[model samples]
Target: MWKWETEEHAKAVVVIIHSAFEHHRWYAWLIEKLRVEGYHVVMGDLPGHGEEGKYSRIHDETVNEYIKYIKNLMESALSYELPVYMIGHGLGGTLAVHYLKKNKVACAGVILSSPWFALQKHGSLIKSALANLGSLTSNMKLTLDINKKALTNNLQGYQEMDDNLVYKTNVTVSWYKEIQLIMKNLFVPSTSQLAIPILLMTAKQDKITDVEQARKWLLLQSSTEFQFKEWPLSYHNLFHDLEREQVFMYVRDFINNTTRGLGYIID
Candidate 1:
């Protein structure tokens, strides 16, 4: 786990959860942005993701482990006794939804960036059947074949990602199975509504995750204060995209508004 404290008095603590196949280092820009904006930031590499993936790869058994890890991070954020907000991207966003549904942690708000509720393309029937069978019986790994061009339009960002040593391109069948299980359960009606404010952003041109699925999930949320925005001409990684300044502005505004009446002082 890593914590970046702001030089100024903080208005709140923001815990960020990164997507699959990526690590905390990829979020350096976002972290510094939040820190400079007067918010303490907390984040870590997911299990079998960053430094951990060097030794062990993600398998079927790490599903519950991921939730436990997030719970620990959330506990650390709560220690500051400040209003807490969570930001989750891609698979990270899906995990955030799972964590919130099962746990009763107090969060002032949540921001989801292009959450991966469903894939943009599912392979042929034969391939799907084979994948299911492989997941049930083997721990074989499969290549994701993710296109860098589909991620962001920033050429510098592309270069940075290409040079990243810990960026994984393959995942175990069990890992895929676990992700599917979580996505399936996300649609089941919750016993209680999540009353906290939520901001869900999606890229209309995202070639990775299904935008329609994200929209459907947002409508099912019982939170009365939830907001959804779909950005046109953007890729899957909105934070690393060309309109990131505007994206950051929206994030700052949401946090400020959510905490306005709860003793949050604006500069």
Candidate 2:
């Protein structure tokens, strides 16, 4: 767990949840920027991420377990006794949605960046079906074929990803099975509507998550105040792309404006 505070008072505390196969250290750059903006920030490493959990070995985990982890981590920020907001990336973003819907957390708002609400197909239907069936064994391990180029548009970013310390390339069948169940529930609207504000950021060139599908599901939620920003010239990892500073600026401006009750009007 890591927390950064500014001398000046902050409107709200922001908890950052990093993407899949990554740890809290990976978000240092973004955290520093948040601190510079005078926002209190808290971050943590997920169960299967960080140095303790290596890519060569991944545990069998379910959707429920992932949600439990997220809830526990957010409790640290809750101790501050301030309105807490969440900024989650990729898989972390999906977990945030599940956490918000299930628990009555006193969060003021949320930001989801390239959330994996829907997945892109990498192979034929038969192969996909086999993999899904294979997950029933629980011990089955599937190799992930991550295209480095799809991670970011910047050449330097691509090289850095190749050498990333906490990167995971192997996923367990049970993990995929659990993720499928979570995705199914997300597509269907919830009975109790979400009341807090949301900012859903979609990548135009994302190769991992389905941006259109995410937009469609988000539009179905009518009870929440929300805004959607489609970032162009970006891949799945928008912040690690060539135009990272611009992306960070957009997020900073959003949080600042939201704090002052000057949220950007929907187009």
Candidate 3:
């Protein structure tokens, strides 16, 4: 787990959820950016991810059980008694969406950066079938093939991603299946069911998640308190891209304006 607290009480607590095959510290830059803006932040790696992402080797389980781990993390942040907001990237962002759907907690808002709401445009149907089959396999240790280069266009970001201690070049097949299940469930629910504020971001050049699908979801969503932005020059790692300043500004202002007065400025 990773956390940063402001000197005084934070105006709002922002829980960060990292993308696949990466730990919370992958969000170090973003966390400090939010911390300077007076928001408390907490995040960690998911199972089979960081060195300590998993507490123990658990018995074989389904996707719902895997989601429970993130649910517990969300609950821990809510215990702070401050307005809770989520900043999730990629597959983690998808988890945040599912969390809000299954539970009716008073989440202040959610900011999704390249949420994995759907698979890549290529081989999506085949991937879905394979992932679904992988889900039911008794082999819990199976690994899924992944393309790391698609994460970011920045060379330094890729270097750091490779240097990370627990980084896995590929994720478990079960994890892929879980993501497939999440995306399906996420799309099946009525957009009208959402009640909290939502900030959905799409990476214009993302090769992993489908930006068009995310746009359609945002268009159909019922929450009038929502905002959307598409980073035209960014890759999958929006926070670590050359246009990161713009990404940070959107997040900082969203939290600041949502919890406090609307003093957000762009330009």
Candidate 4:
């Protein structure tokens, strides 16, 4: 189900997508901020996380399945007769990119916060290759979430979040493979037929996704309307970082600027 807040004079709709092991509540502050600013805010739980039933481990999910969920959500919002904008973090960010590439999903713009384009630290190519082999041979439950430092540094509040609210962080081999496929598609040309603006945030000290790779991907874009910000003092989860207020300001400015230009937002 979707939870939403609309101001009396709302002008635009903003949809917040959660990270891989997290629920939609991760964007609770952002949603409230947007609603207070007269923008309608909508968020929902994705399959295998939050309110949705866990179908299988992370690796077991196919990209098509994830895309279907996003498409259905976007369609449902369109049914309500509202202009939609997308804001996604981590794996959710990657899913947003896939959605923009595949469909003419109407949106004023898109905001990506430290999207998981490439895992900076993890299994080697040889290990992944072997895992692929094993996956083909047997239905092995690849226990891939071994990174204890995931919620450290920038994500200090992660520990405060209940384990059940956020996922306990276990993944399978197929999930890693799915991530690899998504990353591979990143370097390919952008298929968005719409000239919707894009905002991408990267953490300078992030240990999870490869910041440099994200930079390279952004550079490949021919559109100059895109905005890129690198937070030198922040880590992976920019929204929950110690300097999160600054990050939120960045987010607010981007949304305000682009939507104002389109005449869909004011102030």
Error of 1 at 69 (Å): 1.0
TM-score of each: 0.92, 0.88, 0.83, 0.86
Q: How does model 4 score by TM-score?
A: 0.86
Worst lDDT run of 10 residues, candidate 1, spans: 121-130
Write one digit per residue (lDDT tens) for candidate 1, span 86-155.
Answer: 9999989999989998899899999999998988644323576755655354476655656677899877
lDDT of 3 by residue, 150-255 (tens): 7788877676667536444443445556667678776665743576778988888887778988988776666768898999988888987768888888887777
User: What is residue 79's positional error in candidate 1, in angstroms?
Assistant: 0.7
- Candidate 1 deviation (Cα RMSD): 2.1
Q: How much does candidate 2 score in TM-score?
A: 0.88
Candidate 4 residue-wise lDDT, 165-231, digit = tens:
4354665656666777888887877555325788899888787888888878777765568989999
lDDT of 3 at 16: 86
In angstroms, give how far residue 79 of model 4 lies from its true place: 4.0
Tell me how candidate 3 scores on lDDT: 0.72
Ranking by TM-score: 1, 2, 4, 3
Ranking by lDDT: 1, 2, 3, 4
lDDT of each: 0.83, 0.75, 0.72, 0.72
| Per-prediction CA RMSD (Å) | 2.1, 3.6, 4.1, 2.9
The TM-score leader among the candidates is 1
Once superposed on the true structure, which residue ranges of model 1 sit more than 4 Å away at CA? 55-61, 122-136
